[model samples]
Target: MNTTPQQNTQDRPARLTVGVVGAGRVGPALAAALQLAGHRPVAVSGVSEASVRRAAALLPDVPLVTPAQVLKAADLVLLTVPDDALPALVEGLAETGAIRPGQLLVHTSGRYGTKVLDPALRAGALPLALHPAMTFTGTSVDVQRLAGCSFGVTAPEELRLAAEALVIEMGGEPEWIAEESRPLYHAALALGANHLVTLVAQSMELLRTAGVEAPDRMLGPLLGAALDNALRSGDAALTGPVARGDAGTVAVHVSELRKHAPEALPGYIAMARMTADRALAHGLLKPELAEDLLVVLADGANGTHGTDGADGTDGANGTDGAPR
Candidate 1:
């Protein structure tokens, strides 16, 4: 791994003794990568059966010990605990006088930057946030998958070179994340990746309710294509009744969803309404068509606009039908 630019090629340490503070899904995978990079994974801390298994499998023979012992044994410590647990863990460790001056303390929480490690920093340990922008499965295979991922790095200006090198050695690119933007960056990822999973699962369940054979298999290509198109074409990839302004088809859709899958009806209507809004905003749907689609979605399968304007339910009697 490359060293700090301030250090001529020769002044840098050849390797660091790394301690893993938690052998969760992220910790062992990172330790394995650092091991492959020639760093020593000296010790790890874990309590759960799964955590123990993962550490043994990925960092074999690396001592599984108490958190204090792990900290004492290493020059670089990686804290991979849950986001909520980290601040307390650091503060507790620092309070016990486990953290030391000149040691590197790093955390892998996407939602936080080095600021959360204030306890360690106060104790004179250098702090760094090196969050890999990818999920982990707590397997050795995850180490291999790190090759193309971006790590959202937040480090003290003086310690940046060391942090970047560590990230690079673990087979990731370091994308500098400012301290204040960590939350927004993390939010975007959750909205896209996590929500996509929920949306897809909802679709799969709906297909099962429709009595489709092997619904997952059936959805694979269609969902894949839709995702690819959406990514490649942005708002232009929108399709279906909302985009086409087929109020009649959308009204029928609401009727069927309400009849067969009442749970999914609200979600369907919400998505349809949002899609129509986006389609209009992006100029993909003409104003007249957008108005009609919005009315139908707002009023539901009654096949009528609710009288009022955008809300369609402001106070309108449901007598006006969608434009024929």
Candidate 2:
């Protein structure tokens, strides 16, 4: 993938003084990418000794220091800690009065906005959230993948330009998202990216049970094509038995799942219901057909139909015979 050239000149001179907290997957990756983009990573710190060592190996000459030292010496502080630890870290930094006014504090957590850094913000430092929409598996492959990725950025209006400038400096497109919408936006990414991994693992397990020698080999082509199609055309890429509303095929699938893969029944039904909803949204299925498909999946979930008024007649599929 091609990336825009790093913006550095005598006038601009690429802000090279960076401090990174948390030497986990994203921290090291970001540090490496920043170095490649002409930024200087001056100080690095993490809770785990192994993580610290890993980060040290990446930036061999950079100083390893405490979080407080990082805040004092670096113009840009990157907090790549775990999501749950973020607020506490910021609060701790604030209590110590370590954050200086006008300093840039950024985090790489996908699920949060600058709100998690409220303490730092209160201390007069600029808070920025820059989350890349790609997975980082702590491998050399990630270095290549970072190029051309999209980064969701959220910051105070006063600091928005600087946040966007940093994102572009790292060879990523800066996508602005409202602070209030951060959770829902992150939820969409989790559902579409993270949960897809679980779904694929489950599929591979089922394929293994069915005697496929190499499930990944079998799935690679099919999934790759599906992903490509979805990327190119969005919902218009829908296909397979559910997209076609093949009730008979779905029934057979439920039956087989019950016998050979009872563990997968719940996921299959839930995803089928979701697909029915999407099909309805796309105008691919008539209201009645979509409702019927949902009912079939829900009925399987409860092990019976027409009992407890849970026959999926509650419009869960969003096909109430009204205009979409």
Top candidate, metric lDDT? 1
Candidate 1: tens digits of C-alpha lDDT, residues 119-154: 899999999999998878888779889997899999
Tell me each candidate's TM-score.
0.85, 0.86
lDDT of 2 by residue, 63-116 (tens): 888999999988889998888899898999999999999888999888899888
Q: Distance from true position, residue 320, model 2, in Å?
A: 31
Runs of candidate 2 with Cα error greater than 4 angstroms are: 1-14, 286-292, 304-324
Clashing pairs in 1: none
Give all candidates' CA lDDT scores: 0.83, 0.79
Whole-model lDDT, model 2:
0.79
Worst 10 residues of 2 by lDDT: 315-324
Clashes of each: 0, 1
